[model samples]
Target: MSNNVPTGAEFKEQLRAGAPKMGLFLNSHSPTVAEQLAHSGYDWLLVDTQHGPMDHEKLSNMLCAIASGGAKSMVRVAGYHDRGGIQQALDLGADGVLVPYINTAEEARQAVSCTRYPTAGTRSVYFPQRSMNKAGLLGYAGNANKNVIVALQVETAACIENMAEIAAVPGVDMLFLGQNDLCMSMGLYEKYEFPHMYTSPELQAATETLISEARKNNVILGLFLFGTTRVAEFLAKGFSFISVGNDLHHVLTQSAAYVQDLEKIAATEGKLWTRRPTALF
Candidate 1:
């Protein structure tokens, strides 16, 4: 019930306590989608600029939309080398960042340092930026370092090999698993049948080992899925923070279901399904 004012630190606390934290992934650069999902009971929403066509201008708008609806915005920048995009995302008021393709502990260290101030990190300071304008310079600078979350995606064999060091990087809050990338990295792209992503025993062994390493460090572990049904599996595997699904997938699923219902209605009523408003008080 603590809305708008909660810090990413608090979110991490919940995660550390094994509490379930739910969020939706948004690839559409539309502020409308951000606004709607923000108020739709999601604890957090990620605007993925990494793989999406979202620009800074649109990202700012989307952040505003998320703010208006009182949901935390976690922006996924392309990569840690994407310093400009990362800075802009933080400037545009992202509550956190999901950095991708981090394959080494040094890279993870660099990514964490990028989010801090001088002596702590190399993040340049500028007052009255987009993220700072709402709260003024005093509060913004005071909280930026404490409030922003930095989650790294571990999707490579090298990353899994260095998972322990990666997890121990100071200020690196969480480590997320990218299913598609992990599968592809293991040379098993397009092979999702029966849950064994790669036939390579090494990949499976590495993934399991990495998960164990994450647990040992007391760092937050993240898992991504196309839907919530798989959450039980992740949860059982000791994952606390899981991204179950996203807007695009939700839209497709709903659209397909609607089409199927329409066909059923047409057969039963001998006509197309008609739209109607009804109250169910």
Candidate 2:
């Protein structure tokens, strides 16, 4: 990594300054894909461990690949309470963590604690680890507490009710709104169609509450917008940390579209062939 690349601390400072940072969620478990996207100008890349198929070895390789491109890397651990998983990600050189299902202030605090060392928190230390190698032993140990970001996911009705307290929790850097899960938790998923989910009065009110609380607490507001269509609208509404979409979604969508276009051209040329099933293997 180049020395000129901004550190995670600097990235957090950017968020504090209200600069919008766009990122991509990496679920393909391919270091080549990760490195490619990292170099493609995203501010950051998140390795999805919760729903993605990556184990510890794959996660470490992905983080290393992300670093080579100078983009900050974060890991979405399997659960809010997965302390060991959180430690592993940071140990493997992740810039921070995005914890899911953090519904209360205490849960947020626990998530933050897992990123720090003793006195500040209870994260266990391992010498000569990837983080130590990247940041230097003493430098990483002494400053990891301040540099490591702790972003909590607010995806439930309980989280919305405790938004103020959760936002005010010490060491909480960013609060990410998980839109689909929030809508499902609030019963708006079944009540509204896909297009209506974002505009539904109930979801909008909750989003407003989160924005207000984040501003009041001086924390960065984040969201998983799914794609680029609504990014401008949300950024204007006060979300600085936003993920446009994931790797798998982009690959699938673009590939399918290309194939469809080819089929249409073939049909127009009277060269279209009948579809046939292929062996799975």
lDDT (Cα atoms) of all candidates against the true structure = 0.81, 0.89
State the lDDT of candidate 1 residue by residue for 1-281, as single tens digits. Answer: 25455676787888878887788899988999889998898778899998777899999999999988887789888888878888888988898899999999889988887787767788888977887786788778777787788899988877887888888888887888887787777666554553677445755687687788877778787877887777887787777777778888788777777867877888798776754542411
Report each candidate's C-alpha RMSD, comma-separated, in the order given: 5.1, 2.7
Number of clashes in every candidate structure? 0, 0
Top-scoring candidate (TM-score): 2
Clashes of 2: 0
Candidate 2 ranges with C-alpha deviation above 4 Å: 273-281
> Which runs of model 1 end up more than 4 angstroms from their true locations?
1-4, 190-195, 198-204, 270-281
Q: Please tell me which predicted candidate would have the highest lDDT against the true structure.
A: 2
